[model samples]
Target: MKDFIKVMKALSDPNRVKVIKMLQQREMCVCEMQEALGIAQPTVSKHLKILEDAGLVQSRKEGLWVNYRLSGGGSPYAASLLGNLKHWIETDPEIIALREYIPGLQRELVRKKQASPAETQKKDSSAAQDAATERRETHD
Candidate 1:
């Protein structure tokens, strides 16, 4: 009963609900969530802390960065709560707004993922092309 009340209390906040809905798509860093939700980092962290305390969110640290996602708790009650949240937010207008931010967020994530290979290749190519143009200009 006490756990149930805590879970309910966590879900009662609209910001927390939005954060959960966002997590349904992908794990996110606090910075990305701040951009998507148009909220300050501290506010996002607060919401995340509430969700974490309720067992609705799980987080892991990668070096200095911590990423958060929906927690797949072993408890049946926690699972049911997560399911209900999924169903409720999927149909809500606020959650729909989250969809608008998703594409940009996904693109950013992809860009980050692609950076290691893409960065050097792109910079080298650009430099080479600039050098070629300079050579051509001098020759002309």
Candidate 2:
């Protein structure tokens, strides 16, 4: 009963459930999750921590990032609950949208986006300049 309640509480949040759904498709890092969910890094980490404590998710350090995925082996209750959840929420529109968005969410892209703000500003300025050049060329 305790295990069941813990699992239920871990899955209580919509964001945590979304994280589970996303993990079902592929492993993801904190930055990728932040970008996909449009949530802050700290919030995503908190959700991941909850999921981990419930034995529903596991993490491994790879290079500079900590990758998270659904735990395939854990307490029987957690494993069973995870298996059922895979088939349970496939029809939700929010879940469907996340599924569609997952394929394009690469870890590297997220890392680049999370780069220093100055670097991002420079990239943005360069892109604007290129766009202006293209417009001028088209007008000539």
Candidate 3:
């Protein structure tokens, strides 16, 4: 009963449930989750903590980053819950609609990460030039 309660609590939040649903396809790091959800890093960590404590999610630390996924061999209750959740989601139209967004989300994150430092610097310089031009015009 305690385990059930904890699992239920962990899944009660829509964001956490979405996170789990996202992880259903593959393991993800915190930064990946942050990009996918478009939420703050701290908020993602908080939701992950609840899922981890409930034994529904497991994490492994590799050097500086932690990777998270659905626990395949944790408590029986958690495993069972995930299994049922998967089945339920597969049959739900609302969740099925998410398939279209997942690829875009993943691609956007990868594109952002792959942007060159020079590109960002160029943008910053352009913005500074624009600001200076505006200031000069105002003074004149």
Each model's lDDT comes to 0.81, 0.92, 0.81
Q: Of the candidates numbered 2 and 3, which has the greater lDDT value?
A: 2
Q: Whole-model lDDT, candidate 2?
A: 0.92
Error of 1 at 119 (Å): 22
lDDT order of candidates, top first:
2, 1, 3
TM-score of each: 0.70, 0.82, 0.69
Using TM-score, give the best candidate's number: 2
**Model 3: per-residue Cα lDDT over 1-140, one tens digit each:** 88888888998998898888888877788777777677887999999999999998999987766889999835777888899888666755645655456666553455567568999799889999999999999999
Q: For model 3, give the 10-residue run with minimal summed lDDT.
A: 91-100
Model with the higher TM-score, candidate 1 or 2? 2
Lowest summed lDDT window (length 10), candidate 2: 72-81
Tell me the lDDT of candidate 3: 0.81
Order of the predicted models by TM-score, top scorer first: 2, 1, 3
Off by over 4 Å in 2: 119-140
Q: Model 3: clashing residue pairs? A: none
